[model samples]
Target: MIQLPYPRLNVIFEALRYEALPQQELAQRCDISTRTIRTDISALNDILASYGAQIQHQRGKGYHFDIYDETRFLDIEKQTKKMKSSPRNAKDRMVYLMMRLLSQEEECKLDDLANQWFVSRTSLQADMGEIREQLEQYNLELISKAHCGLRLFGEEQAIRACIAHILFQFKPSDHTFIDVCEYFFPEINQPSLKTDLLELINKNHIKLTDEGLHHLVVYCGVALHRLKQNACIHHVDQPNLSEEAQKTAAELSQTIESLLGAPLPQAEIDYLSIQIAARRVTGVPEIDTQKPTEQLELTQYLLDYVNTHYNYDLRNDEQLKRDLLCHITTMILRVKYQITIPNPLFDHIKRYYPLAYDMTVAAISHWGKHLIPDGEIGYLVMHIGVGLERNFSLEEQLPPKALLVCDSGTSIVRLLESQLIRSLPQLTIEKVESLRDYEELSKVDADFVISTEKVSQKNKPTITVSPIPTSFQLEQVNKLILMNRSHPYMLDKFFDHRYFSVLDEPMTQGEVLKKFSAHFTEDNITPIEFYDSVIERESITSTILGEGIAIPHSLGLLANETKVYTIISPHGVDWGNGKIAHVIFLFAINKDDYEEAMSLYDLFVTFMNGKAVDTILGCHSYDEFQYVAKECWFNRKKDW
Candidate 1:
């Protein structure tokens, strides 16, 4: 039941003194026209929609009101009694109660509800009329179906968001401290934290509670984040620390060990100390603070970015401010290495919230005044396990300087240099110096001295393997270079080759030739080339293996054990004849076959087809390649 505060509405409502009968019966009993009663029914339904209720008509029965109220507005009056109450307080209060009842049942006996509210049924009906009007604006619907319960269903997350809205309205800003603390440290005032903290604090000389420790950490994270924002990654120094800076470090160290149960790494400790010092110095606002001025413009840009760039929708309301803050926090902590998120959480964020992470990167670079480029960049992690296995190809970065030392003068050095430069693309020969100038070697800033006859330049790293270091050296050296600080985690990313195969994934030239010799021949021997002439012939084109496969191999593979590899593609790849299915190999057998075997690659493709070829390609690992060669390549099938 609702109070009909207005006198006119009250009089009209009470006028329905004899309203016990159904619509037709009531019209006859009250001596009103049935058409007039119908008019009343329609106007009454409209009023109920204003109150956030819908009136539905059953086939054989009279119409009933279905109120839509997911907000559970029953407590609106209690919430609104505070000083911040809105002018439309009365209506919102009515909406709240209606919402609660709507959650219960689609239709209840009007007499029963009116009795609970201590008002007449007519008064309750008048209130339903008010709810019906505002239903559309709120994106709600009121349906009256046969015998089913009423539900306020639209978006469940949106419905729950009303709780956040209520907190915004009546709850004081002081509660934001509670909210932030709960987010960062959910266990602070929580029963478990409180109990555990109390037990620990009792052992200390001074009294401390869970809330105290939580607020300290929360403030520390905020302060530390601010510190990192100011300290430039490559240039931060320790001379600019204040007294309070020193205190936060000591406290953080103790808390990390005592409270968090994890000892702080020395590197993290130094970084945090620097940030704490930086936060005390006042300087430019972080990247996002200084802006292009228009408030609405910035908001709209954020909205568009959120909607289009990300998979999830961002809140368009004032709450977008909070989302922006979260983005900033995540970016600053991650980019500066101030915090290391758990590995699994990192994977989840990377997978599901890619745009969030992207936004985070932009926010960090923009605010922190860093030049980290933002885009779809990929990282490579390179490593090699065996002496004979070539793990990587180089030619990406300008190679380190090298001094090629052969006993001969410039002619011998130039010939060896030409051989290396042609085949080993990454190695850059700085100079070809004579053996007598070994004392002058100290002057050359070369990374390595590559030589046959060893000269003494102990300061420079030397790789002493003929004119050619093995292919494994090339792979290992490149991987080693990637591990240095200049590459920034490059060696931590694409280091996995176990999942790739010649039959499965397309590969470089060297993998194919090495693979075929390792399998097709009984000796499992691959030719190794020491000069440039052997490699130049095969670099011209591909060798198609046939039947939906192509192995574009290099004569470089037959040169050594490390150059041996297998590459396969089942999609019937192209060579120059419009298409090429497969290539068995490009073999290098000493200096003679290495140059002459370019003709052998074209001859192998004409005879293979179907399962006969696939069985050759299906070998899982290196050892199994021998089995595939014996069974499929030789037309004899056997398994162990």
Candidate 2:
């Protein structure tokens, strides 16, 4: 396996994720000089060639990765992933240095560190300054000794938390050790530490996030090293721990003591309990698990808000409630200690799970205020989002069924039903009867009604086909089956020509939002309160999804009726957070029309995921916008 410097490897990996990028664009995104990027690419290719992968350069399109043998390429990826080595970039290096400092029991001299990294002492000092700033976030500081080196000094709890937070940020392979001490100093690595930790977790039936589990294991290893040097955690006002967590912590301490062949102190046990309590798993809360009055009240408030606005029956979801309570409990401790956990998946979460992300933003605004940042909100989104996904999955698996109506004999009807079943594995034949049997029936009770004769049952969808359906008939049936599986009707009514507008000039997000919303207010299409809610929602988090599309919608139903307003800017406008959005969707829905709002949102997401955005960007007229949307919706692939 080959290793590139910290950020250089990271930058190359990022560049490989895209199709192609211009040299200037690549350099700007990586925050490096073009010459440095070129040199790095050359060096990276030399390493990649060994794994049957090469970074290819186009004349003017920048660099892209070409893999000649996927198996070999993946092998290298796996090896590199297991190593989890530090990137050579400045930010990663600072994090690496901090991890090294946190894991050490003694001061590390500046010259020694510089010599180890083959860097000048002055350069190392600059990195230390950055590390100092990061430590200050946790209320920790770097103390320099006259004849000695620098050492980190702070509250014992804060130092432990800093170590946990730093280790948690890096994702290690399943079989690999997540211990920083192991990464920096292999001789100090305890191979049995992870094995013993897992055994303790399993014996006590402890469950935690993968990252949480890794952090706890690494923290325990470092704590053991420090405690051996007589650096024990002092007493502090501790947060309450659950009975189950207390037991788990005791078992963990016993396991560690056994592994090290030493008797653990009471202070170590208490510290372990504190760490365990801070990351209690997401499960049914124990009967005696205590919750702070204010946080519990806020949890109820948020649940009610979600229920009232989205009409989701989440109140009965014990897992969601328990998860939220545990998360908030941990959050309070993090806030009090000024401990920040950086979420590496923030961008991906914001982009892929906008609705969940939006709901999280609302919750943060209502409860967190200065306490929660975007990173924490992202984790909250994952918890709530999983519940919502489960709900949708249940809806999709209700079974696709079809009603068969033919003026033929019973044998022919059975043959048609069998052929239909054979063609569509997911489809179930609900009814097989003659035309007379069909006419006597009051209604159709299936996903789609397949009749030889043309029968229209108002809102019910019916397809006409021969007794022995042709290939084209099967295609139509397939399309109808897909249509039936889509969300509740009212998609077409959501978007209207009356609400669509083409801007004469590019405007800021605020200007576009205000201008489009005022039209609704003036026409009595929406209430005055609606405008305020939309703007407030935008302020909570920018709705920009990049690639020139922004969806701004209020959480509550303040509009007089459900409506979607499309405002297009030929030149993209700044939608905050360095995003320039050309397409803006102003969605206003009534309280009872939540279903329609969600359906419209799904369509918009699909549209943005396809080539429709390109067509939309090329459009000069409102008619073109509508046409592009129509084409995209019909051709869009089902991702959800």
Candidate 3:
């Protein structure tokens, strides 16, 4: 029998499941390219020949699984089920090795593991190197003795935390508790344990987010596994807990004891209590007397930092303050204890809310007290993103007003008014007047005029349309409204021909930054410290927003004058982590213009969409750049 790779097997499964699938659809389902799918199908046909089956492809309809011998096909199908159960790649092998080592106290020999997994010892050792790097972040070490092989050496609590982190590391977004538990804890009854834990949490009025609940349940499973091995956390400092928290801890310990059929030690119980407190959602008011002064002060400092640096005055938002207070209080605990709580929506949050994410990163980096992980940063971004949304709503300016002139009767005027309102809600029609009345008016109070007849308005811009406006007319109105907005002014204000450059040579990120910084400093646009600040900001988090685009700015407003240096790297700069930036926008913002510069982020967000960066990269001069940018902006008017 021919052994098919995992991706090829997935393609086969999808083809068999569907009657007929398009090549594009199959590629998307398998997360591969259409070219790869075609190659796989060709290879699969050869392999399936021995099994009395083949994958038939049509021109438009993609691929279909045809079987001539049911017995042979069934044999291969049964083998695929077994193949799916084992580790398929290096990442999966590393996970399997981590779980095996963490679950047992005995030393694991690389040669033995290599034989068991049908791999070379060299390959297993390379995987062990990566595993060691990951474990170091959790304060755990992998120690190897000459004769005894390799063993994991860490505190019992840290070990268990590592176990929980590993289990949730690559968890799918749609994976259930049972799916995760059954894979990681095959010997334990996870369904029963989950039921007992859920009931106990409800009975005790314990507040945990769905994510928090999942974390607690998985921690309990790890605890049970360690306790069964007679390896327990001992001699740890008892955390300071409130009276209510102590009672809840006692109840939780009892529930665990009943499930384990053994009494937990005081140290283990204290550790468990700390976990619960870390994960628990507090219901205390924002101004509760028990609220820690340090956390409140830190939260206030964060808000002030964003307001001063980013020109977003969220300091006065009471709800934002409350949310930040609650989240930061627990976040500090998680950071202090090195606990890992995965943020499942971190990617989505970062992608959709780049400005908010960048603001959160900058604010936290300015705080400079703790080395907060990306997961915690993601949670902070959510809070700050909502606060920004609230601020935008409250301070949003009114739409452009337009006057309507129709030659028809009252019925036609009414119909045009309704149609215009439905199509362009952002546009306000001040009044409706006939062409003669519009001509007779001395002064028009509206910004623009929309008319059904071809009439000229000297004061305001006039747009001619049918009584019933077509889609093109509506689009023209929308484009006009968007142009009247801050987008065009923003483009002209920051981007300039003097500051734009096209680099055809290959360079590193540092070289590009240094070159841009030198030019700015020599021109007296920015201070010498600007380069260091930009480097510091990048060190905290790379400003790359993906899709061959990067918006690099300093830690604070360090420029003498606000300007944006645009660089188009045709050969691509080697950004760290294997990312390449084909278009770079280095912002040098001054403190005086910081308030008006807030709209700059929106312009960058617009360019981050589909093919906008590519279109901008293709520009050879400032004129071309400006044209392509305005085109991109006009196309994405609805996003604003």
Candidate whose TM-score is highest: 3
Tens-place lDDT per residue, model 3, 432-454, is 88889999998778867899988
How well does model 1 score by local distance difference test? 0.39
Arranged by TM-score with the best first, the candidates are 3, 2, 1
* TM-score of each predicted structure versus truth: 0.21, 0.63, 0.78
Displacement of residue 395 (Cα, Å) in model 3 is 4.4
Error of 1 at 425 (Å): 3.4
Instruction: Tell me the tens digit of each residue's lDDT in model 1 across 1-640.
Output: 2233433222223334223234554343333335555666566555545455544545555444454763532233343243122112243335334534333323545566456545576765676655655443335556654555344543322222222222222222333334433433343333443344334334432232333344323334433332232311232334434455455565555654454445555544555454344222222233354554333333345445434432223433434443334333333322342222113233233323322343333322223342222211111000001100122222355665677778766666666677667656666778766777766544556666777686675644455555554677555444333322122111112111332355566644454444454442434343333223223433333233334344333322344322223444554344543444543433333333332232222223222321344554555564464434323322311111
* lDDT scores in order: 0.39, 0.71, 0.78
lDDT of 3 at 255: 76
Off by over 4 Å in 3: 1-80, 120-122, 170-184, 258-261, 286-292, 392-480, 638-640
User: Which residues of candidate 2, in runs, are more than 4 Å off?
Assistant: 1-86, 97-137, 140-154, 174-187, 202-211, 224-232, 242-244, 247-268, 280-299, 316-353, 368-492, 496-535, 546-548, 567-582, 637-640
Query: For model 2, how does the per-residue alpha-carbon lDDT over 1-640 read when each residue is reduced to its tens digit?
Result: 3445555566666657557777666665654446667887888877777788888888867677789999888786576565455434465557667877776778879788667655677877887766888788778888889888878788776777777666566666521234345575453344576777777777777777666676677777767766665667767565676776778888888877775568887777877877766665644454233644655765666677777666776777777777777777676666664445668889778877887777668766876445576777888888888878766544435778888888777887888888888888889888777777777777666766888789766445688988789999998888766655664234446667788877887677778888888988897878887778888888888887655678887756777888888877777788875577778888888877765467676666666566355578777766687657655665653333
